[model samples]
Target: MSAVIDIEELRSQFLDQEFDSQEFVLKTENILTVARASGETRAEFSDESHPDFQAPPALLCSLASGRHLPIDFPAMGGIPMDGGKAVTRHAPVRPNQTLIGKTHLHDIYDKKGRSGRMILIVARMEVYDTDDNHLATADSRMVIREKPTS
Candidate 1:
């Protein structure tokens, strides 16, 4: 597991500070393979279908990188762990379309637990199409546990 982080310190650093938004432009090719495997049929994602059949919901959910979580969290460490769930807004993605994703830190909360202190980090991500149309929005939550050390 990673060294226990000072939650207070981290909080202070982010308090009232605006996190720089990260924007990513993804091409259709970047997501097609996984989209297809996720049951997104070619007909629904073909150039011919453009502006018509929307991208499957599952495909968009699968695109998340999950890199927002801390590297040292126990569950994410060498030991097995369960990550938090992501709530997605219903939307469709189109084929041959370029999508842009914008990510920002939403909120962070601390709680007292049996192990010690636990921190919950929430991030909001929005995906848009070339025309700036909203495709989907996801609120991803990550839980990190802190254990006391002698």
Candidate 2:
């Protein structure tokens, strides 16, 4: 197995890094239709009077926060492909709602691999409403494989 990764060190690289969190302000005109067969109800994603309603869950996770790029993978000695779990919050998102997403390194660990070593990078993604209230949080995991060069 490879050496464990230092999440603190990785997070420091993103410290003071500011990103525009305003891109989530989606216009009603931008709303897309969800197939009826998808079982999305009007009360769940849209209103009967207006077909152009936004889903809060979708808006919360709309964009990849800038912090995603800087995460370090100990096995690769650099950033790995962005991977995360899909999380949904119970709160309803309304149109013209603004959201901010922040990402931080959560943990890192290693496991033995058949060929060499495998490393896992875990990150926490938090989304907040305009009021700074936490809307949802997700634990994203990235896996890196370290194979010896022949």
Candidate 3:
């Protein structure tokens, strides 16, 4: 196992600070391609020619900033792995529009698991349009655990 980690200290140092930002242009063709590859049959998601064509709900899951997590995360001395991701959409992502994704460290915590103690770090990305309209938020969870030794 790792040394004692100060969760509150890390949270205070990282949380609320913007670590990375990226801009994504939602193109019609790209949206259609992603939709089709994901086996989407909805006209609005898969058909660009549709009057109400828009990106699928899961599209934001693929949009990420340059850095997944803050580079200076506290060393928990464990094997880090991708826990999972969650996305929430507030508005339709239409084609030919630019969306800005700003990423920050949202939270940190530790819990005991079947094998040992594990630390979970949550990174949040807030998506907004040029008009400063909140469009979506994606939270990426990373798990840190010690290597199992027989």
Taking all chains together, the TM-score of candidate 1 against the true structure is 0.57
Residue pairs with backbone overlap in model 2 = none
lDDT of 2 by residue, 1-150 (tens): 344454456566643443323336555444334324345566546553464445545444544434443534233554465555556574555557786667665666667767666656665666678788876765566766654544
Better of 1 and 2 by TM-score: 2
Better of 1 and 3 by lDDT: 3
Lowest-scoring 10 consecutive residues by lDDT in candidate 2? 14-23
* Top model number, lDDT: 3
lDDT string, candidate 3, 2-25, tens digits: 356777888888887998988998
Query: Residue 14 in candidate 3 has what lDDT?
Result: 86
Error of 3 at 142 (Å): 1.1
By TM-score, the better pick of 2 and 3 is 3
Residue 100: error of model 3 in Å?
0.7
Clashes of each: 2, 0, 0
By lDDT, the candidates rank as 3, 1, 2
Q: Give the residue spans of candidate 1 off by over 4 A.
A: 1-52, 69-82
Global lDDT of each model?
Answer: 0.58, 0.55, 0.82
Candidate 3 lDDT (Cα, whole model)? 0.82
What lDDT tens digits, residue by residue, belong to model 1 across residues 21-71? 344544566456655666656665544435554555555654454455433
